[model samples]
Structures are given as C-alpha cells and as structure tokens.
Target: DTAVSQTPKYLVTQMGNDKSIKCEQNLGHDTMYWYKQDSKKFLKIMFSYNNKELIINETVPNRFSPKSPDKAHLNLHINSLELGDSAVYFCASSQGGQGGDTQYFGPGTRLTVL
Candidate 1:
C-alpha cells in the first residue's frame, strides 16, 4: 500500500483557472506538509500542519491554500492560478514535530498553467 498518495498525477489548465489536489497518508503521521518544486528544481515548503497548528510560508501566494480535514489528509487548493503556478506539488507526512522526522512523499502532482 502507498503510504502517501495524491490524485491527478498530472494537471493542465489555463491561467485564472482553479484547481485542487488531494493527498492522503496511511502512515499515521501527525504532521503533514505541502511543497512546491519549480522548473529550476528548487523545492520550498508551502505549508506545514502539526497538532492543529498551521505554518504558512511567507513566500507562498494567497492564491494557494492548504486544507486538512484530519491528521491523515492534506489538500492543496489553488485559486486564480497563474502561469507561475506551474510546478510539481508534493504532499508529505512525518511522524512527529516539524523537525527530524522522516517524511514520506507522494508521487507528486504536476500542474501546468498556460
């Protein structure tokens, strides 16, 4: 069984469109995060959720939102998507705090905004 899973492995949409990516982890981890990898291959954390506290990266745009209905799930919703929004979005989970725990990553959802 996949420890972490994400839907719509690939997505293509026009600028200004809205999209969402669903993520779930079976590892029973208490912490979940969303990361975005740009074309340059630089990965940056968009949001982190732990113990009901959410930490949002300042660099992330307001158009991006992270929603967690429970500990095992985290979803990314992008509104008014722009060309710069095209990237690989990865969902990850860790056992403990945001620190040293090993994170399991999902396959990733590639979003292309034209």
Candidate 2:
C-alpha cells in the first residue's frame, strides 16, 4: 500500500483557472506537508499541518492555499494559476519529534499552467 497518494498525478491547465490537488496518507502520521519542486529540483516547503491543524506556512502566494480536513487528508487549492505555478507538487508526511520525522514523498502531482 502506498504511504501517501496524490490525485491527478498530472494537471495541465491554462492561466487564470482554478485547480485543486488532493492528498492522503495512510501512514497515520501526525504531520503532513505540501512541497513544490521546480525545474532545478529544489524542494521548498509550502505548508505543513499537524493533527489537522496548520503549523507551518511558508511565505507562498495568496493564490495557493492548503486545507487539511483530517489527520490523513490534506488538499491544495490554487486560484488564478499562473505560469510560475507550473511545477511538481509533492505530498509528504512524518511522525515528528520521535526520531520518526523522516519525510516520505508521494509520486508527485505535476501541474502545468500555460
């Protein structure tokens, strides 16, 4: 079974459109995160939630928002998707603070905005 999974592994859409990406983790981790990877393969943390509560919010654009409905599910919503938003989105989760914080990444959602 996959520890983490993100729906619509690839998303291609035009600018000014709204889109959403869904994610879930079966590992029962307390902390989950959203990460953006650019062409250079640099991964930046976008948001992180612990136990269904927001904990870390990177200084991302207002157009990007993340929601965690439960401990196991976190979804991302983007409004007016811009070309700069064309990057791979990765969903990850960790147990945190117990020597179990090693992040496990999903297959990734590739979003392309034209």
lDDT of every predicted structure (CA atoms): 0.90, 0.93
lDDT of 2: 0.93
TM-score of each: 0.94, 0.95
Question: Would you give me the overall lDDT of model 1?
Answer: 0.90
Top of the candidates by lDDT: 2
In model 2, the runs with Cα more than 4 Å from the true position are 97-100
Per-residue accuracy of model 2 over 28-61 as CA lDDT, tens digit each: 8888999999989999999999998888889999
**Worst-scoring 10-residue span by lDDT in model 2:** 95-104
